[model samples]
Target: MNIRKRYLVLILFVAIALGAVGTYVGLAFFADGTSPSGNLASSDRDLLTELADQQETIEENMGKLSKVVDAFSIIQENYVEEVEDKQLIEGAIQGMLQSLDDPYSVYMDQETMEQFNEQIESSFEGIGAEVSMTEGNVTIVAPIKDSPAEKAGLKPNDQILSVDGESVEGLDLYEAVNKIRGEKGSQVVLEIRRPGVDDLLEVELTRDAIPLETVYVDTREENGKLIGIIELTSFSENTASDFENGLADLEEQGIDGLVIDVRGNPGGLLPSVQEILSNFVPEDTPYLQIEDPSGKKTRYFSDISSAKEYPIVTLINEGSASASEILAASLNEALDYDIVGETSFGKGTVQQTVSMGDGSTIKITRMRWLTPEGNSVHEVGVEPTIEQKMPEYYYTNPVQVEEPLTFNESDDKIENVQIMLEGLGYDPGRTDGYFNKETQAAVEAFQQDQELNVTGEVDEKTAEVLQTTIIEKIRNNEDDYQLEKAIDTLTE
Candidate 1:
């Protein structure tokens, strides 16, 4: 094969391949056809012509490259075993990218790039959890709220031991996920080792088209104040619209205060979170401070703030990272909202996706981000105003409330009762101590959903089911201690 064909083949998985970026800087002169360097006609021609101008230099470098090509052809022609063209080309691509000495700078093939775009930009079919290689282990960062992973009981910091009976210990992060991810409706079994648990937990999950839980709105009346809660799973493609809708709905309801939950949420698109943050910050207030590799700093500002003025509290944890960290930091600096929960997952670096000649792309870390107050939460992470540790093994089996609960009774037990009610999707209004009309209706709905007696009261048996069911959910997901703290911060 010629040098041009080799580049095209290699570029199918390279960043500096001959097309999108123009032929490799030194190799473009040898390739025929209008320079064949890049899409930029003028620049490609000028650069190629410039290389052509130095005949001796071109010849010298071309000879070195030709020798390598000759060796490749000889190996393909006279190898002991048959060698596929694809194997030779892909190997070269991987070798080239590895030479960069940067793990973040990688050459992704078409399939891998497509999967990546589906993840960072949009949606995908999977168990609905964000994972990463932390401390040399494939760890679950966070299961998308209400996604298959959460429903199946996945939690933050859970170490993945195996996938579908195959050990994932030695596999790379991407490789492990590739093995775990599959077609929608297909089952992918994950064996996880939870903290403080000696026995490995076997988790059976069916991959589904994970819904974009970008922003979910839940409101409650605590202390006779209407509290609006927005759980942002990630700043996805639809996050801005969903967030705007949630805010509008809450504003319509005359929301008294706000509690934004970023717990167990891996951050997404930057613009989406920025849009959401803008709603809270004052107009023309600086939001983020970004510094490029060249040391140039840029500060972004908000155009407007939401009309609704209320006290705010944000919930964050180790799973809350990137854009989530940005928002939490911004909220504390600009709005001075009470940030509850644990410290955020520090991911202050920003990535830039550069498309290659083929359909592949390279996502390279290009810049570092800081809070509006010029604080970098990169490795150290963003700490919350109040720290709360979550309870573990709270739902291993069954659970029961302290006592039977009845509607219209104002008592402290009603708080846990309401918590369990809200946790079970019953929507018992504001989780206040008093069981109001909404709480009674939600109780009836939960009873009906569970096919039990349609009682608008949490009796002994009903309290057991509600507690156990919600506790199981909390077990599958992380503890709600962080969120509870945020609610308390807002209510207090």
Candidate 2:
């Protein structure tokens, strides 16, 4: 069962007898950072005060609350643009949260609150991607598997510079998400700037219905032995059950090795991940370390054990985050499971959501996440045992092609150019996995169609345009070198 959500609602006040006013303050955010050890010498602290002195303090706080109420009333009555009382109250709450300067601590208005709940319910529609403020830049955490985002070639760690031609350079994560999402069948254009890339890449994509499919699995044979691949899109409600079912299915297939791919999986519910890990990890042992406000470290243990001794390998990349990092770190730290691919997204902070009535909520960062081995995965993500960098055009490193691919060029990069050209409706006649005359002709046609110089070659400008156009509709093909490497690692 889910934990009951807590709230910090403001109680209504009444003008009391003899003009006395009342106000109360909760101490959840107030902290002095005092040590929690028993050696502290503040046992003789004053515990009692005069009634008049207490009354004075209460009145002082009351005056502050009164000013807020007065401001709310003024805004509701005198603002040129009509504003509702509810809007004013929500605005006040939003203003307070903004003052904290913590990107994770946010005020969810009624609409945002409803969307947030629906998302947790694991049913919603849009590009189907998770985003966050990474180092003050609005970055893609991960794109859900088989969703419009994945179809659009949106990769993790891609910083969104603009949405639909509007600059979102300093926009908050929620605002950026709102700008990116739209009605089904609508189109959105994203100007993205990725790490280790020299230029900007603009991806034009269509919004589609995001189905509630999180865990994806398939089995294949390599060297006459079966290898099971479990691809986790996100840590949603359906993940654990789907994962268990996947394991059962793979077991029936007589798999020799297991490869858990969290390449682009953004994390989900903590409890959900904990439940999933319980199957493979040992019980009564620390699988994760969480540090509270006072710097006290608490270890979270697994609940159950697996009957089968399965060798597991986890595949991660820059997009693997939160719950993804947890699964990777726990398996490696305790079970010694090797992680392949690139480093994961370093989001180590834990957010706690408190609901305010009328469908409003506030999510605040409460604690820091650490691995069971006492390693911090926040900002400095979990480094893979085998770091595998992807191709430059794989969206991880979107560098321009310095050399041009002309006729008779039989290089590997030319093969990709041929594939991309074929994907963009310019048939290259025969895709012999080389840049033949047909490939050069197709490049010329594409350049002519885009009003370029029609150079019949793939230069820096042509490569950038080709990569951007490739995001229109991505194929879940063998182009994922990192994934192929993980599969190969497990099979070998």
Candidate 3:
């Protein structure tokens, strides 16, 4: 093979082996600096002989790929606009990944790859939201707890339409994410199309360093029983260890039951989730099953022989995804624990990042992860044993008011205001996008409670205060019905 052909063959081998072993172990044969034509070690020679035997198949594939090479040459030699070779190569890789139609698989350039590594290893400066491409739109999976995204009112399934007033219509998931992330204290504006809303919402956020402290431990006393609550925000590098330590401390406190809450968690490393699952899932049954592209399945089990002495319950929501879903599924199916809350964000595929030996990488979905019952929750989310929906205002959109909503004016923003008012203990009387006298009374009541002018109208300032108050209440867990159900499940 010529130099270009040899380079392509090496890349193909690397991609194939990376999918199988998740490492570049096949590159060891080439590390000896032996040329293909030069005398080499016996094992290397045997490998080359084997390649020679399959040269026909290799050439056949290469021949089909010649069209792409020809297109690249044509574009470089005679395109209307000048394009760099690096750009073209990266674009080609991205195009291939896009063709797979899998939103989870994506191409990451060197800079993007570095940022990704930082996110997994330590921390990164961003708005702190996990996003995925859904139906050709960059959609928010969930906002990290206490991150700018969450503080800015970004919610799950919110579709990002633009960044800084520039449309993100053609940008990929990472490209849009890069635009949304910046240095700490830098501001980024996102135009969002939220579900069940008539107008697009513009959310401005100041980026900050998002730490990877995933595990949070607390105790909730229910019916005279101290129920330990372990909330995993994400399954980062040290999450398993942190969870173990937190659980140990909770056990030391002599808790009666445990609530594993992954309500708003996005997800992180698979190994992290696997390690955490090993603590609760017994070894008698498989905790997870991974099926490769060829339909081959590999079952993974925990080392534990028995369940925890305390009754355990899991909490999930639409924001719980990937690794979070894995943990909830294993706990529910393998251990027969009760899962409370809404259905989870269904993401059943496992993505593996394969470096291209040039700092760049491709995050490809290499396998499908199944629950212990061998059920896949790809688009269909995990069903809770006891479904507990939050209050209506919990799903309310932000009330963006350019024009004041007075009595007799009906709009979606008015509906949001009504929901917030009702959630804040004000009697809005109606929540069906109607701004009547009752809604005006509720607005005036809210305004008076906040010591603002009792205008009986939903103005910009009133709307802002309403949203802030509602957000504070939600964050403070003033009405966490799902958590209450989880605690009750254990206490009962």
Candidate 4:
């Protein structure tokens, strides 16, 4: 009985010991329904494997990404410091523009871009001149005639020292313009130093509506012949229309010769220049052409029908550029018209404005203009036919004419000056030289032709003679004036 009890006790003790060990193992590593030493229940292993797979997928997708930006955005949203979104956007835009290598390609905000466009369109008000920054200071390029900037005693080659008491240091042309331009009637104080002037002159210009002088015309006899002088200031939107009207006016006044002045004219529109060239060139004559990157060529032609057939002379200067060069080149090539004055500003590249999805636009140089002879005038200026230097008198007071006898303000007498100049054997170059240098030269030649004094100066007797001969030509509808004068002189 004692031996049997001892065996049962030992069996109960071993069962208790095994149960205790299993419970301890379960609590230590498999309490959440798994096994110790890498052994696990099937359901538990499947659930854990799914979780592991999901975690691995998430890490694979996002581990490569730098979350610094996202973190920064989050911080910015909840940041204590107030930051303007527009400022940051503008800064980003500036940074982007700075990346572009072109200095002209700049990022102008809505306000600045709008202001720039308006300023270009009006091209008036403000200082009544064109300005650009050079050498870190504002520089005056050209002053328009009768403008406040011109009348208020501002001149070209003047270095602007300061604007409104602010030193224009480290500023670009755009920045200088922003400081100089203001509302009409507002004053913009500009300290300028002219070439001849020693001390810096403080020019307090009372900003006014600068009247844009597109075309200026004058009719007076030169060297005894009635001639008309026209100076085109700029090639604006309405410049072509204005030029047409000027031509008509000169024609009505019996304009014998035409002098086209294009001095200090920074070119504007392309179509306007084409329209201007049409007045002299015959129809279908190529006015200008441009070649694109894809080997495509676009050509513009003359369309005007009532252009006069007379000696035409064109005057140009260093400021003449773009459309001016186009017009001058077309006339000189097509008509062999005489060109007087200095070389033109060489800028033949055409810019095409393309707008981005954002309200910004990019004016890119799309093509370069080619002359009729396939010559590039991008850096090389057009060579003049006559290459006449502008006389001091012409540069000073271009409208003054020597002829006392004015032409009849009628179409019949419109060609009178041409006949008179041609009668004098002056060859003002083209009969189109309404009152330009060619006509003046012809008048001087007429004085010389008549065996009188040849001073290139017109006297009253010379004017009377030229006027009478031209009137006779108009009445008789004679094409040759100089021939008749020679015959009459020989008879006399």
Candidate 5:
């Protein structure tokens, strides 16, 4: 075969090996401008010879796909509505991927492909959150640090019920993402159903260009020792290099300890995290293992010979996912380091995006990534060595006020308001859902302190102020229990 033909054949072989294309129909569908002749082409024959053991299985599967071809022909010829061939083809591909029952395995159209490419290369105009389909709902994995989604108080695992008032039911992950993304400066309203909150919340966000700067470095003084902090927002393309440079700079400054925080980090490229892992994990054992479809496991190792001279700690929370989990698990399992914080957002599978000749692509979950100890954290997150919970108010849901909440109103919204009130130092008498006389008095006290109308009732203005004030306090780092624990672990 010629060079181009060889490359195409190799790509097809990879797709076939990955179970992405199991039959002649699937193969011919992506062949583009080529028609099936009930026989394999010369290149395909060569490829099949390479898979000689599976040739019988492939042929048997090919014989079973006549039903799909018949259905397509009937739909094209007899359906009352005129259907486009491209649409049907794409739908068929999407259907195959959906049959896997894995949310990470998705088919992306040309437009979504372009947007995905743009997001990886540079900035993209969107709400700036990593999301996945969970229990048939588009759920937020984590809002990017400082993005409009985070600034608007979108939290991890927040289920997106609708975008701009239109329900996202039955829509795939990519479709929901496309709906949530728009031009920079445009408005996108999201209806969120957060866990532990009774009433649904609506968040209005002004979309902006989301930059992909992943690594953030800072210094902290704890116990008369200088500690370096490297916070990874996401494991993007340059995150590994950026982290290396930042670590080098910190070392040059003669820091006593290091803290790696992946609190709200939604993972990105796999290679990126692998590169970062090599810096900490020694060559004594594999940092991680990849289990393929046939249950074959391949171990990957780093070349580092020695551990860091100073003490190191990893900080994680519910928003930490995929690559973040890998780094945390590897460091803890391989190096015996301490991990302090809440459990992570478990996502142990690794996805590989394969192009379908056209601009479209299919991201397939090719393997499950296991920790150095060969444990999978798919649905079960990594447990912290020393468990630490944030303040109660940190987990409070957003209060959506449909009407003024007066005394005797007992609902989850009232409970949220009470929690915020108490967290801000104004005692609501109790954190119960009931809005009693004391709760009303607390609202009045808060209103008066904030220089608002002392209506003694929680109204729209009061709800907004409460949310903004709590967000401000969280952003000001008035109470970061996890970071403090990490610093103490490192310094002690």
Candidate 6:
């Protein structure tokens, strides 16, 4: 549900509270003050009249509630099909709230309400992932690493066709997620279809507790100069402390340059972002500003009290959003840092989750954030300072364009091999129209690691398993391709 619905709900709650209070006070006034034994003046009579008016107002409001209850009773009794589940009613209310056309506004049911609260604490179970519905299909937005979904091989952009034999056609995103997720050790059957596949592939995966870890770090040497690479997946609850430790590790390693990879991150905690930015930015520097619908603006400043001097390069892509954008825009505009890669996923608004009495919570867009330079990045994404294309060889091969090879060994298998190789540092050439030697080498390496026959040939069984793995990785958005690209660019 949107901001409008949230405020509307709030208003309704307040009105109901006031009505109850007024009814109580009015009854007391009539019983105690307007007694026949009491000598009442004109002013007392006026006060009694005012109390009577409040009583009438309370009765009118109760009458409206009665009418609604009566209408609901009529529908429930006379409707063609029997409405058995109370959950359906809750879902309908949630759906109606969402129909207000606001992405942030939502009504959460009992299960989802608990999930939302847990999300704030930055931990949960059953397939760690963020999912969204696009074009009538449930697409994996991002999967938490080492989570059930990630371990089970979910990927970004993988369309969920069915969950446990139930067709998920009209089911919204949350509904689809609830269907896939369950208690640990429980198996969820998923029917998924890739981009260019004939039959729907069924993957039965056991659900597990998915812990949320936000900070990821590694050390790399760029032309004899060691560089510390910190890939912050998202700014969840413990992310600020996590990032601080990562920076301390870098300091211990004595790296000269730093690379912060924010690619494919959908963003998380706001203060966590500010905390991380303070590490690179100077003290009290204007970071990013926010403006609410009421035109009230709040400016957040960097608080890097004391830190080492190092050249920083923040890498971003189309998937970088919210808090990531805040940091990037702050550094890019205020500190004049170089940002690399494609345009960012422009989402400037801030959302605050509001809890309902029923245990469910609603996340509504409360405010819009702006860059330090006062740029509004709402649908218009942030463009990088240095525009770099994933080298032609990185994106695809020129030769494969004209003459594409037909794979008797499924296209899925070849692509899988290609991705593995790309991660291992040998360019798989192009992900384009063919399976070539580059792809074969990737296959060999993966096979060798698996202790399978090092034949490098994609047979039927290999193809099937390969499809499953690739589809899962893609579903998780944990592609080695993105990491490889970031590392390559840093080295270059």
Residue 25 displacement (Å), model 3: 5.0
lDDT (Cα, tens digit) per residue for candidate 4, span 1-492: 245333433443344344334444533331122356634336887968965765565445343322422443445578788776455445544555555544344555555667667644665457677764444556675666666676554544578888989988766556677888776789888878766444466666777776555888776565565667777777776788889998898988876677776766767666567677777776756667777656677665666664465567677766677777887787777666666666786778665443333455444455677776556787577766545453121111111124442322222122344554655345655444244556556666677767766665455566555644544443342442322232222222
**Residues 411-433 of candidate 1: C-alpha lDDT, one tens digit per residue:** 65566667666656567787667
TM-score of each: 0.69, 0.73, 0.91, 0.56, 0.88, 0.69
Error of 1 at 196 (Å): 4.6
Residue-wise C-alpha lDDT for candidate 6, range 1-492, written one tens digit per residue: 345334434454455555445444443332222324333335877968966876677656654555444445556668898875354446556666667666555666668777666755756667666666555688765556567665555555567899889999987667777888888888888887644455566666788876667788888776787888888777787888989998898889898777788866777767678777777766666677778668877666655674347667788776677788887788888777778877887778776655444566556566788887677887677888876544322221111112222333346435545654564454666665367776667666666766667776655455445545544445454544544555555556
lDDT of 5: 0.86
What is the per-residue lDDT of model 5 for residues 1-492, given as tens digits with 9 covering 90 to 100? 345334433444455555543334443432221456655536977766856856666556544655665666678779999999777767888999899999999999889999888777788989999999998999999998879998788899999999999999999998899999999999999999988777789999999999988899999998899999999999876898999999999999999999999998989878888888888888888898888778988888878798788988999999999999999999899988999999999999987777676677888787799998899999998889989999989888778787899998898789889999998999899998999999999999999999999999999999999998998787666789989999999888
lDDT of 6 at 235: 78
RMSD of each: 10.5, 9.5, 4.9, 26.7, 6.8, 10.7
133-170: candidate 3 lDDT, tens digit per residue = 99899999999989999887889999999999999898
Candidate 1 off by > 4 Å: 1-79, 95-106, 120-123, 305-308, 392-480
- Name model 5 segments beyond 4 Å from true: 1-61, 434-438
- Candidate 4 structure, TM-score to reference: 0.56
Q: Score residue 117 of candidate 1 by CA lDDT.
A: 80
Candidate 5 or 1, higher lDDT: 5
Candidate 6: C-alpha lDDT? 0.65
Model 5 residue 167 CA deviation (Å) reads 0.8
The per-model lDDT (C-alpha) reads: 0.73, 0.73, 0.85, 0.59, 0.86, 0.65
Give each model's clash number. 5, 0, 0, 26, 0, 11
